[model samples]
Target: MKRKMAMSKVPGYLVEVDHWNNEKEHTVLLAENSLLICKYDFVMLRCERIQRIPLNCIDRICHGEFTFPQKSLNKREGEGLRIIWDRLREPTFLSRWNPFSGDFPFCTFTKHPVLEANDKFTKMCALDQFMDQLTQAVQRAHEKKPIPGNANRVPVLKHPILIETYVGLMSFIGNQNKLGFCLARGNMGF
Candidate 1:
């Protein structure tokens, strides 16, 4: 026979930490209430009875050597890229303490029972797929090269001043065109 009880939820932000083990292997640490959740294969570490370390106070452990995915951005692509970067850099669910203030609408769920693990796994998978697609699109855009101009061009003017002015104007026009293309492709509302 199976028995179940309603799970109580805690409130806090979810942060991921990477640490290197003695074997120099990277491991992700997820902590809540002093209980550390390592990789699926590692044993869970219980630090609850010990002094609780404030999330902000914990010195981030840096392994010095780590590979990070590259992202591309165009100047014409306004606030969208900035917003995405900001959200990823510091993600936090706002507390719904004051309803009048018009804060976060969704309720925060921190401590759910193991029975809901399947649902959590599905959500995590969806998030990972979405991020992967975003990263690929950015990389492809960065790899694209600018169009080549006339190679075997004829000299239209002999005056040095005229040539310099004409070249400057051409450069400006080319930049404007590139910026316009980026803006159009971005489909930015603002």
Candidate 2:
């Protein structure tokens, strides 16, 4: 079988859900002020950043095992991190199906199962270090957000992972079709 491949995360699973619900490979760009998600453009041979989350807007940074609703078809089980900046709002059935909806308030990341058995990916993996740096940066940025008079009342960044899911839909088929861990070409002219 021909193995399909994309940019691989060495530590654990790091799957990013696209707007269409397809699992896509992304490079995590850790910048001083914002985190950027970059996608590799095969033709350009360079990663293009497609999304940005400002550090100060981060209201929470959490780590835990993924928890999905029982009916979710694409339930993923593994320890992961979730970054949230905005408040989560309940989705209406109509809004849930909207293809052009705005971005979700949070991003979820977990260790890739494929890397679990690969020794080459283990020895030097520094996800913990990365998280430490990120947490510090977020904390510093978070501290700067409170107004002058209410320093003590500023909301502390919550460390608990809160999942906001509406049964995985389009991504279910896409995940099933992935070539190995990366997204794959579909049989019908994918």
Candidate 3:
């Protein structure tokens, strides 16, 4: 039952945090809430919480690696990327709200589940799609293309994935004075 739930949704651009207990090791996956966008040179994690961190705030981005210490001579099981943010940037997440506990400094997916050999192909496909989306979003921001229109009507670059059209235009935004083209990519419910 737990494996079924874990395999249902794949974390897109996630950071793996290591937790060790004696002979066993655990990997916690941190899920990103939304698109990684650079707004005015600030590489912002526009999560549901809306935290902003400058590009320089990132200490390093290690890809295809895991920093967890191994317990035995056996080969390591998981390998993924991690982003080290500058401590000074205060990247803490609200751990608890009732009593307002200490800052978590990061967010992670709760369940630590392992993938079986048969499930590897599907997981890899999902991971590839996640990476592609992150890459495209970051690349678009870095290119510094004008964001199409004004605040009311945002001009999104013409991308097949981002743009959607139906019987009527479902990707446009406008105000009384101005209009903008906005692309609601993932959520395109008619």
Q: Please name the candidate that would achieve the greatest lDDT relative to the true structure.
A: 2
Clashing pairs in 2: 12-111, 12-112, 13-110, 13-111, 13-112
Whole-model Cα lDDT of every candidate shown, in order: 0.22, 0.54, 0.28
Regions more than 4 Å wrong, model 1: 1-35, 42-54, 58-120, 124-190
Q: Write candidate 3's Cα lDDT for 87-185 as tens digits.
A: 345523332321123243322211123332346534633433444443444343434432323121212222111001121111112211112112233
- Report the lDDT of model 3 for residue 121: 36
Among these predictions, the greatest TM-score belongs to 2
- lDDT tens digits by residue: candidate 2, 29-109: 566566765565434465554678877777666766556555655665545566666655544666555655644676766
> Which parts of model 2 are misplaced by more than 4 Å?
1-13, 18-22, 42-44, 88-95, 99-102, 117-120, 123-129, 143-169, 179-190
C-alpha RMSD values across all candidates: 25.9, 8.4, 21.0
Say what the RMSD of model 1 is.
25.9
Reference-based TM-score of each model: 0.16, 0.63, 0.30
Q: Candidate 1: minimum summed lDDT over ten consecutive residues — where?
A: 77-86
